[model samples]
Target: MAAAYEELDRDSFAALTLDRLARRSGVHVSTIRRRWRTVEGVVVELLAERSSMLPTPDTGDFRRDLTQLTQAIADFNNALRNRNVLQGLLAAAAHDPRVEEIVRAAFVRRIEEVTLIARQAVERGEIPEDTDPREVIAALAAPLYYRVLILRGSIDERLVHTTVETTYQATVAGVFVRKESREGNRKGDREG
Candidate 1:
C-alpha cells in the first residue's frame, strides 16, 4: 500500500479509498480496516516508515554526523521522483487537514530522531547542555527546505556544507540554548 501510494500524486493519494487500496493490493477492505482502521492510519504509518528509514549518523563528531544526515536528506531530495512526491504532499497538505496532520507528524517524528544528535553533542561538549535538540535539528533542516520549496534553488554541495557549519556555529554560540538554562547549567557547575 505504501509503494502504491508512492506511485501516486497528491490528488491520486487523496483519492485513494479502502476499496481502491484493497483492489490494488489484493487485500480485502475489511482486512485493511482491521489492520489500519482508516485511510489516514495507513498513510500515517507509511509516512512514519518512510521517515524512519532516513539516516541517523553517529560518528561521535556532532558536526560530521549532522553534516552527513543533512547531506543525505538533501541528496534524497535531489532525486526527481522523491522531490516531486514531497512537493506534491506539501501542496496537498495545505488544504487537507488529514494530510497536514500526516505531514506534520512525519516532520515531528524526523525531528525526534535527528535531535538525538544534538543531545549526544552536549555530552561531548560540542553543543551547550541547555541547547534545545529540536531547535538544532530545525536549523540543520530549514535551509534545505527553503532552497527546495521556496527559492526553487539547488540543494547543492555548498548549500549542504554551509547549512551544517552554520547550524554548528549557531549551536556553539548558544543560539538554540535558552539563556536562563545556560545560566542555570553554569550555576550548577560552579556549585559542584
Candidate 2:
C-alpha cells in the first residue's frame, strides 16, 4: 500500500483517475475508490514524519537558534529534492480540495514546530517576551516561500541563513524602537 501510494505521488495522482491508479496498482477500481482516504492519510503522515526531523535549538542564543533553524530548512529542501512524492502532492493540491487540506495541515504543523522553537528563545531571553512566535516563524518562512514558489529560485543554505539573520535583526530592532517609544511616552505622562 505504501509503495502504491509512493508511485501515485511521483506520477501525481491528480493526473491519474481512480481507474488509472487501480490499473497501475493492480487493484480494482472499487479498491482505489475505497482507499482514496488512505492516500491522503499516507501523504500527511509522510509530511509529518519529515517535519519531525527538523532541528531544535538549545544554544540559548537567538543568532545560533536562527542559524540552526535556517540550516534545518535548507536540509529539508535538499532531502525533498530526491522525493518526487511531494511534487505529486503539490500538483494534486492545485486542483483537489482534499489534497489542499492535507497540504495546509502539513504547513501548519511546520509553523507550529517553528513557533515552539521561537517560544523557547523567548523563555531563554534571546528575544523579547512580547515578540510573537508566529511572527518570528513567519519572518523566517516568508522569504523562502517567495523565492521558492514565486521566483522559482533555489533555496540554498546561504539564502536561508541570510534571510533568517536579516529578519531577526530587523525584527529585534523594531521591537527595541517600540520599547523605547513606550518608555518615553510613560516618562512624559509622569512629568505632565
Candidate 3:
C-alpha cells in the first residue's frame, strides 16, 4: 500500500482505489476490504503506523526538547509523501464520518504521547506546574499545521525557530496555565 501511495502524486492519492492497492500490494481486494473497509481507512492506518516513529524528545531541558520536537515536525512535513497522506486523510475526514473518527482517535493518542514533553518540563521546573501540557503542545504544533495544511507552504528553519521559541516563551510566561488554575487564582485575588 505504501508503495502504491509512493507511486502516485498528491492529486492521484485522493482517487486511490482498493483494486489499485490490491494490485500494488499483491493482496486480494477482498482481504484489503475486510481489513480496512475503504481506501481512507487504509491510509489512516498507515498514518498511525508511520507517525508513531516520530520520537517524543526528552532532553531534560524544555527549550532543547521543544527544538527537537519542532525539528521532527518540520522534517515530517517536509516529506512530500507525508504531506500527501495527511492531505488525503484530512480531505477524506471532512466527508466521511468513519474516517473522521479514526483520524481523530489517532491524533488524540499521538497528542497524549507527545504531551509528555510538557509534563517533563513541568517536573523539571522549566515551566509553571499549572501549565496545561496539552495546550502547550498544541500551541507548539498548530502553526506548523497551519503552514502545511492551510497555506500549503514548505517547512523552513525560520518557522521552526519561531514556533519553538514562541511556544517556549509563552509556556514559561504561564500563557498555557490550565483554566482551573486561572480560575483558582482569580478567586484568590477576589478574596484578597
Candidate 4:
C-alpha cells in the first residue's frame, strides 16, 4: 500500500489505475478497492502522516510560537517537493466534493492547532486576551501561503520572523485597547 502511494507522487493516479496499485502492492485489486474510500485516501493518509511528524512549540513566547508555526508550514511544503501533486489534487478537489471536504478538514485541523498555541499566549499574557487567536495565526500564515502558492516565492526564516513580529505587535495594539475599554466599562458599572 505504501509503495503504491509513493509511486503516486512520481506519476499521476489517473495514469496509474487500481490494477496497477494492486499489482505493485501484491494485493488483489478488489482488496485495495474494498478498504480505501477513494484513491485519494491513500494520498491523504500520507499527507496526514507527514503532518504528524511536525514539531510542536513550547517556547512561551508569541513570536517564537509564530515562527515555529511558519517553519512547520515551510517544512511541509519542502517535504512535498512535488508542487504538481498539490496542483493535481486541487484540480480534482474542484470536481469532487469528497476531496474538497478532506482538504478543508486537514487545513482546519492545522489552523486550529496554531490557534491553540496563540490561545496559550493569551492565557500567559503574552498577548491580550481579547485578541482573536485565529486572526493572529492567519496574519502570520496568510502571507507565507500567498508568497509560496500565489507569488511563487520562497519561505525563508527571515520572512517568518518578520511576519510573526509584525502580526504580534499589530494584534497586541488592536486587542489591548479593546481589553482596556471593556475593563473600564466594568469598573464604571461597579461604581454606578
The candidate scoring highest on lDDT is 3
Candidate 3, residue 41: the lDDT equals 79
- Global CA lDDT computed for model 3: 0.84
Score each candidate by Cα lDDT. Answer: 0.78, 0.64, 0.84, 0.68
How high is the lDDT of residue 135 in model 4? 73
Expressed as tens digits, the lDDT of each residue in 4-113 for candidate 4 is 55666677656656677787888888887787756676666656666656766769887787777788777666443334345456666888999888877876787777
**Which lDDT tens digits does candidate 2 get at residues 5-92?**
5555456444445555566767787766665555555555556676776767667777777778877776665443323455556766
Model 2's alpha-carbon lDDT is 0.64
Error of 3 at 61 (Å): 0.7
lDDT of 1 by residue, 1-192 (tens): 554464444344556578777877888889999998876667666656666778799999998998899888897777654565566667667867888888897898789888889989999998777788888899899999999899977699999989999999999998888655665645443212
Q: What is the C-alpha RMSD of each candidate to the true structure, in Å?
A: 4.3, 6.0, 3.7, 5.0
Candidate 3 residues 73-187, lDDT tens each? 8998788878888888889989989888988899889888999999998888889977878888889889999999899998899999999999999999999887666667544
**How far is 186's C-alpha from truth in model 2 (Å)?**
14
Order of the predicted models by lDDT, top scorer first: 3, 1, 4, 2
User: Which runs of model 2 end up more than 4 angstroms from their true locations?
Assistant: 1-41, 80-83, 175-192
Q: What is the TM-score (0 to 1) of candidate 4? A: 0.76
